[model samples]
Target chain A: MVKASMSGAVSSMLNCRASSLVLVLVLAALGGCGGASVSVPGLFPVPLVDRIPLPMGLHLDESLTGYVHAEELEEQGEWEIDLGSAQTQMFQNLLSGMFDSVYPVANPAEPGGEVAGVLVPNISEVQFSTPLQTRSDYFEVWVRYRFQLYGRDGELLGEWPLTAYGKADEDNYGMQSREPALQAAAVAACRDAMAFFTVQFRTIPEVRQWLLTEAGGPSR
Target chain B: MIRWHQQALATGCLLNLMLAGGCVTSTVQQVRESATGMNETESVVVLSRKTRPSQEETEADFVNCISKSMRGGKQRVNVVGEQAFRDALFPWFEPRTAPVNASDLPELISQPELAERLASLGLRYLIWIEGDTDRTDSSGSLTCSVTATGAGCFGFLTWEMDSGYEAQVWDVRSGNLAGRVSSEAVGTSYMPAVVVPLPFIAPVRSSACSSLAQQLKSFVLNEG
Candidate 1:
């Protein structure tokens, strides 16, 4: 009776081990075939500020005409990044703070009549690097732009090249999520770009001249 | 048990084959318009609307490939060289400064000089190809350490390349968007050792060029 009981227990243990092994294999197969995706959120409205009351027209260049969503795959799963309309909204918000009247090029009717000059913002490049791709601890985002000031006569007045970077670090030991980090990086990069533009726009000689001349005096 | 093992082996082989043979994915979007066929008498000009400083060489190669492919197609359309097209239109207009937007066609073609120049060239359509091919993602354990004799890397490294391109067609005579074609190709390349390098798992730029050219030919000839 004792021998029989021991034999039965050994057989049951072997069966359990075999079943667990099969289950793991099946799960591994499923994981290899499964697909995953990630997305970046759309642009939320930036804080509205009191208009500066200067006449300025804002035009997005041909390159900045549309939004793009980028995607990638990893050993773990699939990932997606939504570029959102944050680009357009960011510029609009920044320009609104500096100018009294802001006109979007999309609207043909609103060309900012009697405006001093037009500010054309061209998105030169947008690069997003995932942690898996860069082999880095953080997700990275970089945005490069060229801000050009054009006179009413269609002559180029001034141009400034601006670049911004954003990064989000991984949490403790693979516990972190990528989407939030990516979003934070992108937002930070945009904010940095805008801040750079704000400072450079005021200091650039050509821009200073244009603003001062348009305002009819240097004091304003 | 044998049958199950065989099934798993077959699945693994299939997966390996799929990974080894990278896929080419393309998308073509065109506005609803009357299919205007090309004839021997009329010609089409394929040009890069905006060639960045870094992409000049690639742009030139792309333009040449497209023109060559269009000429080789069954349509027998006269694909003009970029130089000839530039010579005909330069000084009067600059594509880099003012890209011809499909939406702003009417205003652009309304210019008398522009219309006359295009008409003189006997140009039926203008195809604008733009965008770039770049390395997007990379992974695996690849570490390089410098030794006294030389530098070497250990372990395996793999990276993904993405090629995204858009070709916009404009009906020169009507100043309307004839069509737009976009192609995207993605593939992963691997390097097992530091000494030996696997160039490209997928030929993205070539794939994009060939695919775009073929589609343009079909679009113009109304073959597809």
Candidate 2:
């Protein structure tokens, strides 16, 4: 198919040159002179995007995951792998593996409200032009999550905007594989949101009052 | 230690041979709000309900039926205190996903329709003003004031309030925020009752349309 398209381009280019030369060369050919060299055509190529870069400071949410390959990543509410609903596991796993990062979290019971902190990320809303006819598949996700900690009295302290980019692999498109990717996407979304809260959690008066005055909070 | 042929014939109860992980479960409950709007019309409508808060002028039976806690036939009940919905034999109910197209569909739900219903019940302009209590609640009396500022309350993008909504009034004929009247949306669920998550508390109203109208009228007509 590729060869056929290439040849089609070459022939069209030749047809154009032939018509132009016919007027100039007819009388020259009548005098038995040789003709000019053949030229190659510049074909239109499709745009291709190979990979999307991961954002910074977004910790993937693997709280429901069943397994984690790397022990260093073994933390409460953190998992390397998780079981996804049936019909798309492999694809999930591929996406999840891509999101190897951490999320900054503040204690919700602190004197002030918690803040969103640093987290590694895996997804983004800003998209590039789609690539045509490769084995890879793509889906777009637009996320809007707030970052910052507020108090009982509604005082605002710190805030940040979280964003991410996400993709799943072509080979393992099953539910299990895809579960990783889905989680990676969610984690990437939360990273920026978490970062914002990290700063906001400290000084928000409402948060402080809620933490200090409220019972079973700082202890819990 | 070898007891020989004395191996007892034992039977095992096949318990699901896996340990269940720790969990956090949440339960949702449905409740109604005492709706107050800045529109002179909203107050009169709320006052007409049978279960309406007599002392504080609050509406009742406006349950949050859409909450996750609702089960089976419970989801079918609208509970808006209408006579048809109230009748034991004819309990009316509604479900939703998106805002109803009030302009095209006569069945579409909107605040104007609610206002019309209130108007039918003889209350023309029951407006409820919204604002924070500048002074702390003291001596069992609630003292506060609401403010609505803009061009005749023409546009409603968002209240710009931290948690709840505030309405700004607009002239429907001229299409501008009149800045003349307005109301405040009071969300008291997240209030500190016993600390903790306070999961039992629900939003003040299930009808966002009715509340949105209140916001507009409150901000435009009532806010100082």
Candidate 3:
């Protein structure tokens, strides 16, 4: 009886050891899986809108054109999101569609005589949340953009801050991969920004004033 | 010889085993607020309500399911793709900018550009869907362990899922609330394991979608 009990105890100890080893390996694997580099798409569908009859100059600085958000998120490790090229491309498409004429200005401080006003846009903030963090079934992203409008003589006409939010259901992806879900969220945010900007542009008081002055002059 | 109670017990066990598979129950109701009708040229678009930040919006797949159902079947109602219609209207139909109520439609379409786009799409009805499916309750436990010879799971696990969705149909041409349809479904799923776990997943959301689509099709077609 003593011999049999000894053999059983040895087997149980061996099983416990094996389980511990497996748990350690899983933890190591999860720790090693922490970095993701994402690039959002630039292509967007043209919006349907009556073009404003004003000539606009798009001034994209190096920082806005090559913007990158890099952060270390505790257990999530490192994340690098490149939104510069995509934002630049989307703005080009959106502005061209909105204005009767859109041209690139070398500098916002000295917009040429050909354009009525110059629009300088920059990313104000980028934030994201994963299912692990929110304890929800969705991955979400939020982007804020600040647009500074400069008049013909390089005087600041107005500055508008636009915010956009997007989310992707984790159940839709059906996998453990986080990159695709985050990318989708980011793309959705960009689309939201485009939609909001297009609809609410004329509603902004300063922009409306600029439009009225450009179209009907100070008296009218 | 088998006793009467023993035979009854065996039969009961067999019946329970048969009932352990996927089973779901659904109820659908409709409220007609105004007259409704549809023509050959006129079509419908299914959109999820995303204006409210606090409320959970309807799932995209559920909207597509309703759209697809409307497009198919014997009645064969014309259905416009959501994304395409949204893109055609652009900013006007966006989440934040979309008209909140039927009363706001006139102001929205007052824009010549938006009016023209709406006319071109031949959109007669806009179905705005809201709600989601969630696991309401869960119990039991499942544990899996691996040995040198093999791996297996042991235990019985079960969960309850509930789906509730409401679709509001608007007659865009008239800018009137034609009707509203609601679908509610409840189901319990089971996973019983001795060695390998056997999953019997109840299609709660699918049931809700199917019932809602059926009711919506009938409601739209019946021109009273």
Candidate 4:
């Protein structure tokens, strides 16, 4: 009877090993197939700034209004980020707060005579890095923006590029998943872009000169 | 039936086992650079230092813990939410633009608009927390396996954790360094497995957060 019991215990141990292997295989399969798609929130705080006493026109092309980034990494499945209307709305709030008045222009080539000058904003590049890629505890995002200035007569005056960065710590989020952390980082990058532009807009030499002329009178 | 002495011996063994598993120690210290007090209308905010990129920042949950803890209890005072305060004073309190020292407050509040905003919030103090919890040491290992009928584990594991945090209270209204409080905690957690793994986790970080919050509350209240 003792020998029989020993044989039974050995069989049980083997069965346990097989079951554990199956469980691990199932979890690995699920984890390997899971990918994330995140839609960033458009909400931004209206900055407190002394508004310039000049009416301006803002031209937002479809690229800035409806932007989406999609990529696939080896063995990491696929990722998609839909930033639709977030950038457009952010710029709308920023410009309105910065200038006395801002009106949308249909075409930048022929901006009407109602505005002092026309401002055109474009997204030059967007890049992101995951914790797995950087071997860090944070997910980071970077956005590059270029602002073009046009006189009321539709002449390109100057173009300036600004780069903004944001990061979110993985430990701060629940479940420590990729979607929420990535979305938070993306929102932070947008906020950083807005803040940098608001602070540095008047500091640009060309924009400063244009502001002086436009505010002083409609000479430019 | 089991004898009375057997029952007593079993109870004693259980108590000893519990005592062996529960091992967490903590310490708190403070320095008063200036006197501090708060009225009923005045409030405070706890913010983690995020300006330094090379240093490990205090966890968000720890800040939240301090805020939440000080908001309740008998000695509880008014506490402003960190995110709301940052959002309301955007661009100014941001990581890139925030003032590093109390001396910068004169220039910071020089703007009439910012001063007015500060007045509106009745914000009296700004507490900046810095530090993090880390796994100091770890040893042993535990292995588990599962079968269709049940699961079992066999091994032993133990790990040591250490938490350290410091809070610098800045009186925004006066633009003076009010005081500083620091907390430290160390603990060892263990998991020993026979047929099933039994885990005994020591609350290292939680203990540090509690001690820091309590000291901060009293420090702001100017109480012993």
Q: What share of the true interface contacts does each candidate keep?
A: 0.00, 0.00, 0.19, 0.10
TM-score of model number 3: 0.86
TM-score of each: 0.43, 0.16, 0.86, 0.86
Better candidate number, 1 or 2, judged by lDDT = 1
Q: How close is candidate 2 to the true structure, as a TM-score?
A: 0.16
C-alpha lDDT of candidate 4 relative to the true structure: 0.78
Q: Can you write out model 3's per-residue Cα lDDT over B1-224, one digit (the tens) per residue?
A: 56988989877964575486468999999999887878898888999876626337677788999999989898889898988987778767776678888778877777787788888888888898989987787777655555567655566666788999999998888888888999999988765557655666678888999999999999998833
Worst 10 residues of 4 chain A by lDDT: A1-10
Please rank every candidate by DockQ, starting with the best: 3, 4, 1, 2
Give the best candidate by DockQ. 3
Candidate 4 residue runs with Cα over 4 Å from true position: A1-33, A216-220, B1-17, B147-149
Angstrom error of the Cα, residue B174, model 3: value is: 0.7
lDDT of 2 by residue, B137-202 (tens): 111111111124311111101011111222222222222333322222222211111111111122
Q: Label model 4 with its docking quality class.
A: incorrect
Worst-scoring 10-residue span by lDDT in model 2 chain B: B150-159
Error of 4 at B86 (Å): 1.4
TM-score of chain A of each: 0.66, 0.24, 0.82, 0.83
Model 4, residue A53: displacement in angstroms? 2.5
> Against the unseen true structure, what C-alpha lDDT does each candidate score?
0.60, 0.24, 0.78, 0.78
Model 2: residues >4 Å from true position, as ranges?
A1-144, A174-220, B1-224
